[model samples]
Target: MRFCELTEQEFRDFSSTHELHSFFQTPEMAKSKQEDGCNCYYVGVKKDNKILCATLLIEYKGRLFKTFSSPRGYLIDFRNKELLNFFTNGLKKFISKKGGTILNIEPKILYKERDMNGDIVDGGFDNSDIYNNLIDLGYKHNGFYLELDLKKQVRWAYILDLKNKTEEQVFNEFKPNTRNIIRKAIKYGIYVRELSLDELDIFKQLVDSSGELKNFKSSPLKYYQKMYRTFKPLDQIKFMVAELDLNEYSLCLNKELEEYNQKISKLGSKSDSKKKEYQTQIDVLTQRLEDLSVKRKGGDKVILAGGMFILYGKEIAYIFSGTSTKFRNFQAQYLVQWEMIKHGIYNGYNTYDFYGISGDFSKDNKRHGLYEFKKSFGGNVIEYIGDFDLIISPLKYFLKKLISRFGGK
Candidate 1:
């Protein structure tokens, strides 16, 4: 087999049809990274005029030596040891000649099957051979990480398999609480709609608010703007926002209040017990009306949550999301996710990926709440094989690590 550089179209044609294709491996993603100061290369192995293995490697120039990364890539059959070895050997040589110190890869292959509760499945498919093969081929195995820190790609994700399933079937699979929350969100007049590019600030504000509340930093508005510009033309990305129609909610509440008033009027001469029950109903409705009045006084519509999704090949990935703390009880975030899931099902996508969750499942873990929330949607927790580094220049790689550790002090 001969390794060669492929044109953008040529690489896209092959990768899009491959079962292991990810949005991160696309030419558009490469172009976006290029704008961010990385040099992108699309390389493939061909034999008998057919592409075998392919990857989109990005070269990041550092002060000491350059580093290469293949994000969730190397679209290949890991089970085929000979083919993988050939690709790695050629890739290492290619990067070494280009003055790269290390080549990092975080393949999309699963380490082991994990259930929704984050427990390993007994007798499930294991890719220990693939893991061993990389180590044997001279790549260093980064330790399995349960935290979401210090990793290129997230080590864990939640995926809802929508294959051959109807929307109702998928909805029914959700936990009872999740379904109730979605229902409540809808009942509260929360609706989701696609945001045009001009309206991206709404999403940015939501993310910024969430970041501040959670004490995490969010990317600048221009970053999302860049992504939208990059992927929107291909219909490969969407930004959706969940909003509450306060006017409509208020109208509904007023109508309910009118019905309660009529019931009380009709019970003018009823028994004292019946009168008390009607009074109690009226009181509850009146409180709800007052709350609705207060909320609607601000504006006719208020954004409660928003999310950005990436669509590529067969999967729709929920890449980023945030919710308004003020409407937490209404559960607008749940509604946003349900909308995306329904979109995937109606559009015939194979999977809805609730991307990125800390692998640490213990309740004490800071991100455990996120894990539970995603798990409530009834999907498998995927633990990937994690990151591996192919050292091309040992001295350069060592020096870089040494400087990084000591800050060159």
Candidate 2:
């Protein structure tokens, strides 16, 4: 079979038809990455003009870098052992002709098995074994997906099973405090509504504000708009806003409750019987009302759960979520997750990634907050064995490595 590059339109058409295709390897993702600083290309293997396999290729210092939608990586689905030699040999010859260094690939076919909740429970395979096969083909094996499991590699990614679970049942499974926040948000008449392109400005404002607070970078408005344009038509993505008014009655109730609690706390120190009675009544009603409010608001309060969706066909939805800091005490974030899970289950997708997680899980790690939040959702942590590198030219590779090592302080 001959290999050829596929056009953006052809690639998107193919990808949209296959659920197994990862979002990263799609033409749309490649376009985004290109904007972020990478030269991307799309290639497909064809036999008798019928497409057999396709890959999105990125270039860095002459070597090829490939990734599928799951995340940036080397290859998406490099499991066609029969074509391994053909692809590797073709890649080497191509690199040599172009005076390049190497061709590096990390395929998406899991070396391990992952459960529905995105946890790697089984070590399906390991790098050493795969390396041996590559070695036989004169291809160097590089370590990738650092965390390996018999069935699943990393545990952080997950899919919410929505078949039998109702929205209420799913909400009930949340932590007590989280549920209470959703209830309070609802009691205040806070609502979560789908956003439109006209509302793009507000979404961008939220994204920009959030980026500053989190110290992370974001794509331009054009990119987000392009995303909506490309993915929304297919129902593979959506945008939404959760709002609350300051003058709402629940706002006043919240203030009153806070004051009442403060007074009870100060009086309780004296063990006054009258204060105790008032505290008891306040506690019961406050807790009950708060719970009711949370149930009504659903998952809109949670900032992180703002973006949620299931991959429809091969096109996956990128759910962008956020929350106001003013409502933190009520835990709107939890409801955000609950709603997304429900949405995913209803749509039925291959996997639902929580996006980036801390590379290191220690409390001090930058990703600690995200890691903690994703874990509570009850999904498995998946370590994609990490990234691996292969050098085509020993001298150039060594020189580049040396330069990188001592380039700066």
Candidate 3:
């Protein structure tokens, strides 16, 4: 086995035959950073004509650092112990010759479940998973330092699944009252439409509402517009809206009120139980209807889907939705999600991902509310092995520490 540096086109061609993640970790990104005076390199190891592994390295403060980003450093070095050793040795020599003090690596791989429980499983030369390869390579392990697992890692924007199931399956997925409200919404002519680029002002309204409530960080509208144009050709993205009808809202409200009145007037036997249930239903329905009433002018109040998502492949579709304060009671946000999920399923996506449920699910945790909302959808929560780092050099390690504390540009 041997290791060497690859040019941009060379890496891209190599990646076409391997995983896409390898291409992301190509030397080119590092080289681009280097042109700005940051040292960067792309290195790969091969055996018998097979590219076994690749990594990206950047030089900062005379020390080599590993970025190990997605689709780039998505290292699957697990099965190739001989190649990993060769690669690591090559990295040491390459950086050292350039006056680099150390090499740091952060593999885009997760630690196994039991590995987290403090069991140091032996990594063998014959191991297949790259996570185990890191262990065998004499890389230090810090169990507590971790990030979300890959399976559950949510991209900023995504799609959801709604296929192969009956409408009842869709309805059953929501909170009971939520299901009825959407049905009621339909009865009142509440409709959903795909938003177009020219109609962005309407989408902005929804973005602002969501940003405020979630304290979400976002690029400006120009950023989204650019994205809309850039990824549009891929056809993996779309913007959707849920529009309300105030006239329908009012009618639904009146109809429910009439039903409640008749039940009370008839002295329907078991009147107390019936009245309590009916009254609760009426209160919920009325609140939603009243909320919809505000949008009655006919132009339509829109609830926008949160982001640009990639769904050209893979089974899971992720989402980043937010709601307007004005439409909170109307459950417009819920309806929007319901529609998105249905969209995913209909389009052949298996999972409708509500990304980023907090790892800490205890009641006191800040993310508990989000955790619960995602849980309500009935998918089993999967926890991924978190991120891990590899120390490239001892001297540079302390140097970075010094730079962090004492300050260095």
lDDT digits (tens) for residues 1-409 of candidate 2 = 8767778887777765553566556666676667666677666666787666666766644233222222333242344567765656655555555555655554443445555334446655554455455567765544443222223223234333344555676566555665676676677555566677666665676666566667756557786777776556556566665665434545556776787788887785686886877778688658746754764565433222244343555223334545444344445556555555656656554344664453455677665776667656544554443333445666766666665586621
Model 1 is weakest, by summed lDDT over 10 consecutive residues, at 143-152
Superposing all C-alpha atoms, what RMSD in Å does each candidate have to the true structure? 2.5, 7.2, 6.4
- 349-390: candidate 3 lDDT, tens digit per residue: 655656555555467866566655555555544333443445
Candidate 1's C-alpha runs over 4 A off are 258-288, 291-294
Q: Over the stretch 354-384, how does candidate 1's per-residue lDDT look in tens digits?
A: 9899988889999988888898889899999
Which candidate number has the best lDDT?
1
Model 2 residue runs over 4 Å out of place are 17-19, 33-39, 60-79, 95-104, 111-169, 211-214, 217-223, 249-323, 362-366, 390-396, 405-409
Local lDDT at 42 for model 1: 93
Please report the candidate that would top TM-score against the real structure. Answer: 1
TM-score of each: 0.93, 0.69, 0.68
- How many steric overlaps does candidate 3 have? 14
- Candidate 1 backbone collisions, by pair: none
lDDT of each: 0.88, 0.55, 0.55
